[model samples]
Target: MWNGDGTVEVYGFRVFYSEVDCVRRIFEKYPETATNIRPKNQMVKNAYMNNLLDLIDIICLAPQELTEEELRNAESQLLELVEVGFKLDWLKNKLEELCVKKKKMEARGARMRELDGLIMEQRRVLWELETELKNEENEAVSDSARLGFEDVV
Candidate 1:
């Protein structure tokens, strides 16, 4: 356990091997034997619950800042929570709210992208018109100079 050699079946958050190794090192350094601790599975479930709550709070705080993928992930996790007997009315309401928000976000994103494309096309057209006007002006000046020179000759 101290060497972090065995494959750990992580229950709550996704963790890398390096983090597991660090945790192992910490435990090796500071070994505290607590009396009457909860069972391993119960501890894992509590940790999972805490992590999920934290994620929900974060999503509630800044739902707009999250990307579509992130929102989907949260929704799926919420569903998982429901499957695990966490059937709260607020959770269902939050799930519905998140669905609506995701749809709105997608629609807004599509519209914004469309507007950006239109703006780019308009700028391109404007550049071409300005170039054409400058070319015409230069040609007119050259033609006038030529006519003046011929009259003088």
Candidate 2:
């Protein structure tokens, strides 16, 4: 959770500083967030939950509709941390680009299939026309042989 205006709440799992550093001898469950994570005075913030509700809701609600087998077979750990809003927007925009690309590819494939069918039909017609042409030429040769003369122009 973040404070209003996208500031860190100062008292949550995402706090900047904590009072609980220890000698390395003891085991610490949740290590303090690294100093390199932000400047000394700067606060880290999460994206506006409302703005990201579409992705968040998908995360929250997807498991309910899945059968146990589906869950087991599902892809692993696709969910990720959104470090900043810009990255999230880039991801969303990238998804839109992929959707558009997929549609264009599908249309191209459909057109190719239609063209292939047309080509097959045209090839059949071409074969039939060639056969008929040979038959007509043969009949003309036989008639000439029977007449046994050439007409001069």
Candidate 3:
């Protein structure tokens, strides 16, 4: 349970043991970390806290105002992650499934387009064949008329 008062010394965010140790060390080293609790997870909840801390430490050590701003944002985001408390594994799995489904739909669409093109070509050939047959019938009729006139003469 978090005390509704904004002391922020202890994070209500759930973190793993690895994070606890790294955070414990950071808390001991930095007064800000001790008072402001943001749970930074590295890989898993506890395992990756140190990696995030390391990035923060680098940014803090750098000589730029923007770096300070980035550090603040990172800290805030870490706290927000804890507050949201969505499972990372579940999100990863959902993303993978979505990617697979999208790829399959794309392939199906491509195949349908290919089939449509083939159908159009077949239709064109059939129309050309019908036109040729009509021309041949007209030629045969004219030949027969000429022969009948010659017979009359």
Candidate with the greatest lDDT versus the true structure: 1
Off by over 4 Å in 1: 1-52, 64-73, 76-87, 144-146, 149-152
For model 1, the local distance difference test gives 0.59
Task: Report, for all candidates in order, the number of backbone clashes.
Answer: 0, 0, 3
- Runs with alpha carbons beyond 4 Å of true place in candidate 3: 1-86, 143-152
Worst 10 residues of 1 by lDDT: 30-39
TM-score of 3: 0.40
lDDT of each: 0.59, 0.42, 0.50
Predicted candidate 1 versus true structure: per-residue lDDT over 40-82, tens digit per residue: 4654654545545555565675557777777667777776655
By TM-score: ranked, best first: 1, 2, 3
TM-score for all predictions? 0.49, 0.42, 0.40
lDDT (10s digit) by residue, model 3, range 1-153: 223542222233334444555555654554343233343442244333434455445444423333335545555545554444422333234334444555566688799999999999999999999999999999988877755666888
Residue clash pairs of candidate 2: none
lDDT measured at residue 30 in model 2 versus the true structure, 0 to 100: 22
- Clash count, predicted structure 3: 3
Question: Which scores better on TM-score, 1 or 2?
Answer: 1
